[model samples]
Target: MNFFKKLFGKKTGSSNGANQGRANFSGVYSTEHFNERYNEFSLEKDMLDGCLKMIEGYFIDNQIERIIEGPVNHPANLDQVDQSGFGFVLYCQAFELSEGEATMFLAFAFSDYLITKYGFKLYKDQKPDHPLRGMTLKYDKDGVVLSLYPFEYTVKVLKGNETFSALEEKLKANLKELPKVDELLKNFGIGGDK
Candidate 1:
């Protein structure tokens, strides 16, 4: 009788294992990976809307002369291009005043805008940790230029008639007056400085 009972128990256990099979494997896999995928899906729409709204707001507040939507005409070599995935570009005058200073100012403004607007967390792995790792900034006798790609971000400063050296000097001299500039930008809601 005991042998029969034992044999029946063994049979039941094997049957259970066979029934479970791949069905049990489902819960064992992680759900965390799905979080990122879902988050990215949701963020795509949100980011695009946010970018358009921000651009419109900038134009209205700053009273900029012209504000064009979508891909507009730009000089091939003049302005910087930041290719954040949401389809946006920040076009401005490069060194309208030095190449180095214009480059520096653009970097600062872009970085500030990213952090404030998108809640982009900066990684502390580097001295100035932002998603902007491996970014490039270059200056020539003509002017300063930079380009960012891959749905990350970019800033293009257009060069006018000013020489790169003159623009650099102007940026350096204006450093002390940045606070006032900051206040002006704040008024325009550029970086949320207010």
Candidate 2:
């Protein structure tokens, strides 16, 4: 019934084979497993889009700036809180949303933006004991893989110690470094050496 419940519910996928065309994978994980992972992503795409629309509605209703830039540091926005909903105190105060709702809203909205703007893919890592065992964003560029936890970044910013603009800027800087690494490999004849 709650918004967070809808956005963060169990992963679901169709039985029809939906992973037949994927080719961007760069990890050691089997292609079969990667394809399996994609099934869930495919199913969640529409739901995530709907969630974004809901956030957009909230933005318009509240007259809050739709752009993702601002300080998240209010006195009550401490990182220390219940695991179920943490670091959303500032958002709750500013937007008049509950901790759980704010957490889900910010996580989905920002993560979706990063994925769309930067070509990252939604990934659900099912490996036990892995660092990225839950929802993650992954970018694979010519065998170079970058795994990101945008939700974790969101949580940190919402703790009132950082700003969303700073996070976006940091990501932009880091993305610039990836191409340099690729150029270095090209100069070394990584592809031609063989």
Candidate 3:
């Protein structure tokens, strides 16, 4: 409880590239970074829950080993995103279906496999404790857009022209480096944040 008090005591700050998002100093920001401020609570509960369930099912069926949840708190950005580094920092409850038949959701932040400043070294335990890169995925009638929240360290390195092909290539590279989802299913078996 004391640890929670200390952590919730102060306000954390972050920035967007072209504009600045707002944050309240109150511990109400205790959820994921973009969750509370982004009005994630307004999403239709049943549909959002269904989508989340479907996404997880899709991962299980397709053998993709990616984090399927949002950040537990506000997170910073990572400089060198290696193979295992995960960055979609979003709120799980953040989702919507537009009148135009589009969808949007805040993504989760942080990764379990974050290395120290030296990317050469590896973390001993695969724990999702580190606060790293974060962004939101908006699904419109046209397509999906990954809006990365700009941080001093991450935006410059991660945002390279921000084209469709570039985004595809980066995602491909990241997925290729991850462990096989089937293998993780056999081993980790949803053993709390693999």
Best by lDDT: 2
- Number of backbone collisions per candidate, in order? 7, 2, 6
Tens digits of per-residue lDDT for model 2, 120-150: 7766656523442356766666645556565
Error of 1 at 68 (Å): 3.4
Leading candidate by TM-score = 2
Q: What 10-residue stretch in candidate 1 is worst by lDDT?
A: 1-10
As a TM-score, model 1 comes out at 0.22
Against the reference, the lDDT scores of all candidates come to 0.28, 0.47, 0.26
Ranking by TM-score: 2, 1, 3
Q: Which whole-number lDDT from 0 to 100 does residue 63 have in model 2?
A: 54
User: Candidate 2 regions off by >4 Å?
Assistant: 1-40, 43-46, 65-98, 128-133, 179-194
lDDT of 3: 0.26
Superposed by TM-score, candidate 2 places the C-alpha of residue 93 at a distance from the truth, in angstroms, of: 10
TM-score of 2: 0.52
- Candidate 3 residue-wise lDDT, 45-93, digit = tens: 5754554453444334445454423322112211111112232221222
Q: How many pairs of residues collide in model 3?
A: 6
Which ten residues in a row are the worst by lDDT in model 2? 1-10
Of the two candidates 1 and 2, the one with more favorable lDDT, higher being better, is 2
TM-scores, in order shown? 0.22, 0.52, 0.21
Residue 161, model 2: Cα distance from true site in angstroms: 3.2
